[model samples]
Target chain A: MNITSAPPTTDRRIDVALPGAAGQTEAVAWLEGAQAQIAGRAVWSEVRLEIGAGEFTAILGPNGSGKTTLLRVLLGELPLAAGRASVLGRDPGAAKGQIGYLPQRRHFDAGIRIRGVDLVRLGLDGARWGLPIRALGRDRVREAIELVCASEYATRPIGRLSGGEQQRLLIAQALVTDPRVLILDEPLDSLDLPNQTAVSALLARICKQQGVTVLLVAHDVNPLLSYLDRVVYFGAGRAAVGTPREVITAGTLSRLYGVRIEVLTTADGRLFVAGLPEAPAHHSGRHEHDEQ
Target chain B: MSSSALPLAGLSLDPVSDFQQLTAFPFMVNALEAGTAVAIMAGVVGWFMVLRRESFAGHTLSLMAFPGATGALLIGLPAAAGYFVFCGASALVIGLGSSGVRRHRGEESALTGVVQALGLACGFVFLSLYQGVLAGYENLLFGDFLGITRGQVLTLAIVAVLALCGFALVGRPLLFASVDETVARARGVPVRGLALAFLLVLGLAVAATAQITGVLLVFALLVAPAATAQQITCRIGASLVLSVILGVAITWAGLALAYFYSEPVGFYITTVAFTIYVIARVTRAVIDHSTLLRRRPEIAEAHA
Candidate 1:
């Protein structure tokens, strides 16, 4: 068989047909009464949220509050037990390259030998099944690397890079598709302060430059406060959707926590929620601290 | 003279004439041809097998050859047919069994162990039921290349080409899934299908390598070269090329040593392969230690 004769069979076109197209600005994501049950009990009930195109929104919640489950529902990996969800005016999974996703932080094994650029290239056509004839999307891969400021170490093995550098490459991987919506899960979990700020700024730049809607999940919100246009904060089977100032206020958060929570803004404009429960027992001594 | 008493250790000192003598026989030529085909296929598949940390699955697939040969003897069919059928069937079994917990961790190994145990037990049962003496048993366990036929060499060549092509077709996506399954699945990559496809390709590679190296010694061809190459370099393309080169070099050396010293080829192959891997590991450790030492000045400057 001629290995390079055929284009990759996995290069199928996404079904992007919208249901209605009259004077409607297609939302990047929409969910109303989205419910997820665990052990026959709904962790998320009647959750309603709409993410406008090009909006940068943060999904915040304590553990077991279905923040990840919400992202999964948006990715169409999990079906809503109740209510409806749509992404780009179609089912979330209908389009292949419309949503760029950055999964939670995962460190590669030292033995994994893939380079930073190769990881970005995989996002280009990693699912396709054939030998690439002629350097397919070579320029696009280079552009994605440059976009993330990872060109200096683009050829370095992914395992050798620091956590922040690796996360940047992963962002480049997600951006390679030029997706309409970007969904990141806990992208800033282990980053130092500077790297977290840099990644936050980079993501803001991405949203503005490409008009890509961004849904970022994080434990802490202080680093993201400057860039967040909106927030969808879920807690205890309920969700609140509004601007950062509206959703992160003491009254809204105290009601969500079922306990008094103080949302304090320091003089430098960093917000930190105090008097929430302590870190969970399992997470007592870990490097990762729980969100308030 | 006992073959064990032959001067194998001394042959290395005067290797040029020994090498020429190894090429003197027609059987040696056929053996080399088969080894070359087997080496290339094993090298490519083994790189993925190691990368995916599916070496246990690979080992189990190689062992499927045992029952395959015994079953073939019972059914009056060629042993090669048994090897492919058994390996392919086991691949499906392992794939389906591991599907439940692709992300669960530790579950796949338990299932693989069960399948491997079942396969080995079946092999023994088949050997016991055979009415006639199971001749060539030693040859099946510790391979002999002295009687390799031209037809066998051609079969090896075809299987190698097919396996390599299949690997090439899925290599990019396979690496993507293998490295990061969660992100790949999120990006619309078929993570589960890729896993199953990789297992099937691995089965084919195991079947081909089993013919030349025997079931027990298959890892000498499949794991050692790839593992050694990985220890030496952290580049995908370079590691792959290095693995193929290492595989071929060791196979040729093993065949020549087995020919000159009159030993089982598996012994020479496994020994040499293990030695190379150990050398690579030592070299990596040394380089890492020195790099840490070299960075001490930078740490001191930062402190200042």
Candidate 2:
């Protein structure tokens, strides 16, 4: 437990040194003693964390445990109640163009007529006024679709595609801006097992090849366990951050949950948590009650 | 035939002569000009309104036209002024009450229904309080294209131009926000502001459209053509252009039919637009069914 305390003096020094440094090794997102509030009440407080550039991190927790809330705080949608937070060497939302975000899984209505390619293009310049110039941003849109391996059906209407295909195109949309930081919420919630693994591998590749910082929220972390550089687990207004080997152990999780718990490992090296009174164990092929 | 009934012109075999005859009257000329401007604006704005699935909100705004016009008549003002005031004000209320990324959609719909009910009630009250026979009351609900003056045509053109300019400024961002609001907001698009602006622009378009199609039949120019175009194409640019073309064609057809048959232009416009929407739907269904039939053999082979 090498948890750094409040008042991020080390982060301040790094900020001062950022101009001279190459910027690749800097912290992509820094949160010190951060408290998130909704409707004047604190959802979670006393959070201290720092994520370096290009690291793939997974946020795992039960429903209402503030995993999504932390992402929202970092996205600058929700203001922190107590502590300080910064991303990409600036305020939470000041450097938005350099960040790509995939929100919670949403099904496209069957009547939506926009093509998958156009939807991805919106991610690049949808905020701009006037009609889109067809020639502008074409190459990047193509590159993103190809990277996601969705070139075959990217021309089709988004509504007509299957869930997995739509998910891939949405990932392409998030990646179209060539962002340095990628934040996704429940990206794997409705995906099947095979699709879950494939999407995870794709995200891992993006992190390694592009050096993009990836912070994703998930319920079951098994699909992302092999690729994660670190894990942040939230429980009852508190959070624990460490490497998977350090954080997924019985001792750490039981202490975080304030209950007696067991971390069981399968013969194939998969880890699962059992003995939680309210929530089910984090197991594959079992559905957890969704609180969306 | 009643002495006051309009002299109906029979359709001649010569198309050019019929067009010349249709344009010969100043009132008909004004109606055609107003209809063209209204159609173009309605097509573009209505395409977005339908895309956002805010047609109900658009409908509520149109309903405001009734009260606006009658209230103006009661107060000794031009009905057009009433239309713009009531529609724009109600649009602001709806937009302000329900401008956010997600959630509260039920509340928005409920608010729209309430506004619609109040608008109708206000219209009836104004009508009863006027204490005079409001001649051409039927024309207020169903349009009176033949009664349009040249000044009214100019007003519609100006409003159409301004509304189209608004679209030019926010079209891309509006489309993005409408399609995926959460991601749009995450990417720094002002989702709430855009939503409110779109509602305001839709109010302007509705107010302008209600002038020609009247309150009850604004959907003739607003929803039907856009919906039909969407049903026919998946591409945004193509669908928008098609929607405009369909709207203009429907308006022209309704005008010509009304001139020849002595019927309300609103009824003719609504019928034409509805028929076109039905055709588009049927054609799409047929194409999809054939595609499925063609793919069945491959599925069977794969299974075997």
Using DockQ as the measure, the top candidate is: 2
TM-score of each: 0.86, 0.90
Question: Looking at candidate 1, what is the lDDT of residue B296?
Answer: 69
DockQ of each: 0.49, 0.68
RMSD of each: 9.5, 6.2
Q: Compare the candidates by TM-score and give the number of the best one.
A: 2
lDDT score for residue A213 of model 2: 92
Clashing pairs in 1: none
In candidate 2 the C-alpha lDDT for residue A152 amounts to 87
- Residues B1-304, model 1: lDDT tens digits: 2234543443555567767666666877999999999999999999999988899999999999899889998999988889889998999888877872346558888888999999999999999998899877977887777777999899989989998888788888888888888877766677788888788878888887887788889888999999999888877788999999999999998887777776688888999999999999999888866665565678656656
Candidate 2 C-alpha error for residue A95, in Å: 2.6
